[model samples]
Target: MRRVAMMRATFPDALVTGHEPLIPAMTNDPKDRHVLAAAVRADAAVIVTTNLKDFPSAALAPYDIDAVSPDDFLLNQLELNRIATLTCVVDMAHARNRPPVRPVELLDRFSVIAPQFAEEAKAQILNQSEPSPWLIHQRREID
Candidate 1:
């Protein structure tokens, strides 16, 4: 609840909708039906979720929506705008001021949540310039 409030405050333009109309079950999990229903209501082209298995492509084809893993989604964003993505990553690291965060720490955390994306980001970061201490740590940990 606090996270949702923070997100709403941070991204005012982000759409925040109420309960969507119930629709026929699209996946094996009855609870996931609400997700599809919300996507249908919003006419979203892609649904970014960790639970990709719950949203089969065949089920989403009719609605022109595709369920994408977070890793794939972040990779696509990185591909579209490498500099912007890096900037976002840096900003995210800076936001963790309690203990202070390093770029590599952020990447390590991302690696746990999105391994494929973390690898791709690390490669990109390495290609751009001389590796920093944090980057070195990231490489050592990932290897």
Candidate 2:
């Protein structure tokens, strides 16, 4: 929720998308289809979820949506950390935390591992929703 709220505050004009019907099988209230429908509508390139098997590749192939894990998503964020400008701190954190993650260690570990997976994961995170208004506003600001 922090990330979602951040996007709202940071990129208010960003286009964020979500599955409308929300597949019935995947939910208690179950709709006609799952997130796939929404992703298809939005033409998403990646869909981040732990349930990779739940969303079969063949099913998503038509829409060109690639299912990715949270690890992959975090890695993508790390890779794209340049935009957020946390390179030095993130690198230091990663270097400090090597393996056998404890809670505190995990945070530092993610900082380092995230960048490696950025190329593949960045698209999924952005595709999770349309650009937020803030993001759109930032674009205008940049222009």
For TM-score, the strongest prediction is 1
Residue 10's lDDT within candidate 2 is: 70
Best by lDDT: 1
TM-scores of all models? 0.80, 0.43
Runs of candidate 2 with Cα error greater than 4 angstroms are 1-4, 13-34, 74-143
The Cα local distance difference test for each model comes to 0.76, 0.52
Question: What are the candidates' C-alpha RMSDs?
Answer: 5.0, 12.7
- Clashes per prediction? 0, 26
lDDT of 1 by residue, 1-143 (tens): 99899998999866536535445645535778788877877778999988988888888888899999889999999899876786677668778888987766788889876898888886777664776565455443332
Residue-level lDDT of model 2, residues 1-143, one tens digit each, is 98699779978854545655444323211232456666666677888776667677767766667888866765665567734533333343445444532323334344454544543333433343666454454332221
**Candidate 1 clash pair list:** none
Model 2 error, position 90 (Å): 3.0
